[model samples]
Target: MAGDASPAVAALSEAELLSRIFPRLAVDATHSAATLLGPGDDAAIISAPDARTVISIDTQVQDQDFRLAWPNGYRSTGFDVGWKAAAQNLSDINAMGARATSMVVSLTLPPDTPVTWVEDLADGLTAGIRGLGADGCSVAGGDLGRGREISVTVAVLGTLDGGPPVLRSGAQPGDVLALAGTAGQAAAGLALLESGVPMEQLDDGLRNLTERQRRPVPPLQAGPAARKAGATAMLDVSDGLLRDGRRMALASHVAMDLDPDRLGPLAAGVEPAARLLGRNAMEWVLSGGEDHGLLATFPPDIQLPPGFTAIGSIQALGIDEGPRVTIAGRAADTGGWDHFAD
Candidate 1:
């Protein structure tokens, strides 16, 4: 009986591996209102209570999107990968001012992968959904297959609760720009992950930053709250604040002028980690991605939501000037995650 539980996925039949995974994927929800039919079928049937469905999909590839082990000798656990998979997709739904209903995941795994790692990933998926306050969401179904490296793809379904979606193009010139959740923490964590410092030597704060990179805490509730508070434009800050701000500016055809006072606190939060590496914390705040924080624009007349803080204001674009993000009317230092960039 001890010998039967092989360490590697290669030793197990596909059916056997799935049997180990399915049970771990179950969320604790007594009844998922969205999922009329979940798993064990040709497709999942999720209810669209608002007469419309907000859907989003994302993919993560090993070695490119993430690594099994970093230079610091910190191994990326299956739980980390699974948690991130749920986070990135769920954040997208939240950005649209909708609540996640269900998700379907697909995994591509190398033959040498460990069975326990896959099981941990299943547990992580459920944990992320429940831990991130999306307890009502359901894991409807998913697929698994062989591949050269590990890859995970998740498609999420959401409903708007009879409200209109806040979009990137809706920001007016006078709108106030705001942020929900911390900035630069995940990027600072990524720096720590890739640094020469070994995992054991890291202090508690530094270690916590590393965990942020692994399991991002997206501000799921803040999204709907911002929408209710009359958010004009919004998106998850998965691609650094400057880059994403530029995107919002371009879409709305306005300039976004950041207030240094608002950004200073965020920079200070990660200053210790940045100092250890001889880097600037403010740069991370500008270009750091994967924090999954929401960047939103709201009308000046309304009260800002509970989790949101004013970070900037929207301005009219100057003649012949393209959409740009600036701090105190000056150009911002620009660098963000660009997958194909040299």
Candidate 2:
């Protein structure tokens, strides 16, 4: 039988833990809603009288989403873990065109975890919320449990604020396709860091890629802005561009066509990163995930908001036809991220 031989764990009081751990982490202040019986409570409750709430939750597994120990043996900071959890949850809220209000996190960690790690993770979570303009959201409540592998689950709540929630099914034929926020930067960043290529050796474009992967800059405001601009349909580019565009097409019963020239600028940005990795930049731009750009369709003559650029168009198609996503008039074999792909 295996025996448990570990250091004599100093069981610090929660207050001691907070004091020792908090300074190393980011701070996110919450408005009154997140304060109704906060940190010391068994649970947290917030006011939600907006008559409608948009909720989203996500779970990340250690090696699946990210490695605890990278090729350089760089262990991710507690802040990194917390930041990612909050960002993923908040991204979903942004996708629904809502303002994030509050959040709760549940954590499972090894018994050997340091108290500082927990505190820093909390700080990161708050920082992520703040970064997305979730002024009213806080860490609120969470669970601490033991496990062999690290896993985090976060639940977020948001208010629509009298704005209509945009759906994936409202696009119409001849509607113009537009994108808000840049694309392919995150994928390029991951490639540069993973390949042991130093940042100094790369050009400014490639360096931007490194920044994209380390900290995602999601367009939280873009979703609501699109809805307000009378967008026919919308979705955040959580998956790759092709996959997400195809989703809108299927839901709206339209065929989607993207002009490669319109995406040329973004394509140019990923080239250096691709050349360094011996891959095609267009592949990364078309299929990379985690960029979180907003993809929307609108009437051709409608005026778009700042941060948005036209990319393509929606077309009427046969009812029995599969949703078509074409790139520069050609059918693309790989549309985007698929969990089961070999």
Question: Highest lDDT: which candidate?
Answer: 1
lDDT tens per residue, model 2, 256-310: 9999999999889888878878988888889887787889988988999777899
Instruction: Report how far residue 41 has shifted in candidate 2, in Å.
Output: 3.7
lDDT string, candidate 1, 100-185, tens digits: 99999999998888898899899899899988998569789999899988999999999899999999999999999999998999
> How much is the lDDT of residue 240 in candidate 2?
83
C-alpha TM-scores of all predictions: 0.97, 0.87
* Stretches of model 2 off by over 4 angstroms after superposition: 1-37, 72-74, 198-207
Candidate 2: Cα lDDT at 329: 66
The weakest ten consecutive residues by lDDT in model 1 span 1-10
In model 2, the clashing pairs are none
Candidate 1 positional error at 236, Å: 0.7
Report the error of model 2 at residue 111, Å.
2.3
